[model samples]
Target chain A: MEPPRALLFDVFGTCVDWRSSIIREGEALGRRLGLGTVDWAAVADAWRALYQPQMETVRSGARPWVTLDVLHREALDRVLADAGLQGVPESDRADFTLAWHRLDPWPDTVAGLHRLGQRFVVAPNSNGHIALMVNLSKRAGLRWDAILGAELARAYKPQPEVYLRGVEALGLVPSQVMMVAAHNVDLVAAAACGLRTAFVPRPTEHGAGQTTDLRPARPVDVVATDLGDLAGQLGA
Target chain B: MEPPRALLFDVFGTCVDWRSSIIREGEALGRRLGLGTVDWAAVADAWRALYQPQMETVRSGARPWVTLDVLHREALDRVLADAGLQGVPESDRADFTLAWHRLDPWPDTVAGLHRLGQRFVVAPNSNGHIALMVNLSKRAGLRWDAILGAELARAYKPQPEVYLRGVEALGLVPSQVMMVAAHNVDLVAAAACGLRTAFVPRPTEHGAGQTTDLRPARPVDVVATDLGDLAGQLGA
Candidate 1:
């Protein structure tokens, strides 16, 4: 098969260690507010757990298209209320919502991206909106050619429009673009849309006990242990 | 005034030397196709001359939204017909349309963007769509955080939606985002939308004998000689 002309990435668990980053942010906020012995890890999990259900609201047309920031804020409020922290200062809550914008990349993300970017156009085609992606890239040193995905399509992942529009935005046919994602479901969805796919597992994306997405649920064009391995396999 | 949080750039003549780049592409195409003694500079000017009128059709709702690529191709066909080069092969014509994608950046563009991006979110807020901007940025070594502007708004420059949506995409208020352009009218429109404005004159943008946009027609927050000066003045 001909090599893909561009690589579209899945940001959260794929490029960034979002779970760890969110926990770190939560713990730091807890310390700043002198809220003793908060289980930020559990809070992080709770916040992330709402991601899909929230997106489903829009994907299913139950709600209008809103930015990931808006969804994130809404999710954060629910998470806080569930944790009995509804009394937290609005300023701190706002900062915590932005913590998603400050995720740290997996160890190989930056270097691998730089290497792959030398060969193919590389960008995040994730659920995050432009501002969130920009802030995340700046903090993580992820060099993207463009931010393409949910915001551009006004639809969430698993929706064909998100992947199709992203491929079109790069001036390439779906067949000429490769979707690089850790989630088997994301790659599966992209493959269905006629794009190539790469699976790079992040075994501990949801912490060491994470069992889901430890392996690709189906075959992909390339499978590797990490971004660096994927880059090497792609000859980038 | 508080400093701007993001810097939105006007591409084409503002960041890349479009006139020279088009001339170069045209001349090279002419040579490869055995067409001799063509005045490529005139062709470049003619092609650019159609830019405003084409975008105006969309801006005025006389036509629906289309990518700049489509507008450029239509303009190119007209220019070719007028130049008595309508006999050019379809393949060559298609390639010529993509010449806009390979524009060379002004001498200071790369370094200036590098310096400025160290401090602020720097992105192209141009009439070009995402694919066009991505290709141009790659070819020009312009490191943009997020490709914003016309594509995002589905409207061209000088339109309020173009500037306002670009600012909103970055999660910044109009006052916290600065629109930098070589064109007086572009800056004026952006300023009217409540965005801060910086004018960096491109005296030779339309060629040595050109007279338009040599100076700001109205007051702007900052005026500089070029991108480098803009960066320095912005303390980036």
Candidate 2:
């Protein structure tokens, strides 16, 4: 088979440890806001849990087209209130919302991506909108050749349109691009769309709370330990 | 006034020295094809002359949305035949068409963009489609934060939607995004859409046949000698 000309990555849990970053930031903000004994990690998880359902609302037409940032803000507000944090200032709320913009990259992310990018057109094909992903890249030093998102397709991920739209944007057939992700479901979705797939297991993506995706979940083209390992496997 | 948070640059004349690069490439290709006495520079100029008119065809609804690469290829074919070039094989035509993908940047472009990229989000707001711009960035060493193009808006540049679409893609307000270009008319259209504007004169963009845009034709927020000067002026 022809070597992949492009590598499309799943951004959130794959390249960046969003759960830990969000929890750490949330805990710090919670303490400053005088919230005692708050389960910031749990709150972070809960906020993330809302992600799919929230996008589903838009997907199902219960909501109009809203960016991931907006969805994140709405979810944060609800989660903060439910966690019993009250009367937070609007500026603080805005700051909390902007936390998504400052996500930290996984330990091997930058170096691995840099290596891989030397050979391939590497980019993020994520549920995150282009703006959010671009800001996150700048903040976290994630070197992406381009920022692509479901927002470009007006649809969320796990949908064929997302993968197809990304390939179309790159001016390549789906087969010419490879989708690399820690999530088996994402890789499966991409494989279904006729793109090459690589699974890089992030066993601790949920930080000891992880249960699913402990191993290669399907017949993906490649299975690596991490981004660095994936880079090596790809001969980058 | 609040400083512009993002700078959107026009690519062809403003960033890459397309005229000279195309002329050089065409001349080299002409020589390789044994087309002696062929005026490649004139052919290049003639091809470029077809740019605005072709885009105008699309803009005027006489043609559909065609990428700059496709338009360039079409123009190259016409100009080659009109210039009395002979024995240009089909394979050579494909090679000549790919020349646009390998444009050389002006001397200061890489350094200027590197410096400016340190301060603000920098991207190309060009008539080139996303794939073309992205490939060009990789080929020409343009350090763009993101690639924005007319393809995303399904329209050509100087159109309000193209300018506003770029701002929206960057997740910035019109006032927070500045359109930087060598052409006064481009800035005029951008300013009319409420975007901030910067002018960097590319006096010889039209080459030895150059006759206009030796300087800013209209008032804009910032005027500079070149990208390097613009970077210094912007404190980048």
Candidate 3:
């Protein structure tokens, strides 16, 4: 197959270990607030669990377009209340919500992206807004040629427009762009929109014993153990 | 003075030498097409001279929003007719329109941007679309945190929404973002919208006889000779 001209990434899990990063940030915030023995890992998982349902509100056209930042904040409020931390101060809670923008890259993410970027135009096809993507890239040293995703399309992932709009934004046809993700469903959505697909499994994205997306559920154009392996496979 | 959190640049004359680059590309195309002794610089100047009028049609609501690519192509057709080169093939004309995406950066552009990016978010707030901005950045090795400009707002520079939307995209208040440009009018429009402004004069932007925008028309937050000087003044 001809190599893709550009690669659009599903950032949250594919490029970053959000669970560990969120938990770590939460623990630090907990220490600063002297909230002893908070279960940040559970909190992290709970917060992440709300992502799909939150975005579905927009995807389903039940609500007007709102940025991922708004969705994240709304979800944080629900997650905090569910975890019995509703007493968290407004300022601290707001600050903590930005943990999503401070996620650390997976071990091989930076180097592999740098390599892949040399051969292809790379950008995040994330649900995150431009500001969130910019901050996350700055924090993780993840360079992108552009930030093309939900915010640009004003719609969430798995929606056909999200994939198609990103392809068009790069002045490329769907087949000339590859969607790189850890989530099989995202690849399936992208493929349905006519983009090439690559799966780089992040087995522990949901922490140990994670069952979902540990492997590609269906055949994709490329699949590898991680970003570095994927980069090598693509001759980057 | 408080430093700005992000810098939004006007790409055409501020960061890249569009005149010489377009001329060079035109001459090379002329050579390949066996069109000898063509005054490429005149053609380049004529093409650029049409930019504002073309965009004005959109800004005045006389036309619906379209990318700079469309405007450039439309202007290129007029320019070729005016220059007596209307016989150029459609394929060649389409390829030639992308010359905007391959402009060479000013001597200090890449290094200055590298240094400035270390301290503040750097992005293009030009009228160019994301694909144009991305291709230009990649070709010039001019890195950007995001591509925020005309296409994002569906409006061209000097339009209030263009500056406002770029500031919003970076999650920055207008005062916290600096609009850097070689054109006095661009900075004036940005300043009118409450953004900080910087002037870096490109004295030869229109070639040796260029008389406009050789200096800032009014007081701005900072005035520098070029990108390197601007970087140093901004403490980047």
Q: lDDT at B25 for candidate 2?
A: 86
- Which stretches in model 1 have alpha-carbon errors above 4 Å? none
- Tens-place lDDT per residue, model 3, B78-101, is 999998997899999999999999
lDDT of 2 by residue, B1-236 (tens): 77789999999889989888888888788678777777767887898899899999999989899887689878878887888764688888877877777788888899899899988998888998878787888987888778886977899988889999889988889999999999989999999999988998887888775778777777899998888899888888
What DockQ class does candidate 1 belong to?
high
The alpha-carbon interface RMSD of model 3 comes to: 0.6
Q: How do these models rank on TM-score, best leading?
A: 3, 1, 2
Q: Please give the lDDT score at residue B15 for candidate 2.
A: 91
Identify the superior model by TM-score, candidate 2 or candidate 3. Answer: 3
Interface RMSD of each: 0.6, 1.2, 0.6
lDDT of 1 by residue, B158-182 (tens): 9999999998888889999999999
lDDT of 1 by residue, A1-236 (tens): 88899999999999999999999999899889888888888899999999999999999999999998888999999998999887789999889999999999999999999999998999999999989999899978999999999999999999999999999999999999999999998999999999999999899998888889988899899998988898899889
Candidate 3 residue spans exceeding 4 A from truth: none
Tell me, by DockQ, which candidate is best.
1
DockQ of 1: 0.85
Name model 2 segments beyond 4 Å from true. Answer: none
For residues A1-236, write the lDDT of model 2, one tens digit per residue. Answer: 67899999999889998888988888888789877788878888899999999999987878787898899889888987897776778888888888888889888999999899888999899998878887998888887777776877888888889999899888899999999999988999999999999998887878796898888778999998888898898898
lDDT string for model 3 (A95-200, tens) is 9889899999999999999999998999999999999999999978999999999888999999999999999888999999999999999999999999999999
DockQ each? 0.85, 0.65, 0.83
Top-lDDT structure, candidate number: 1
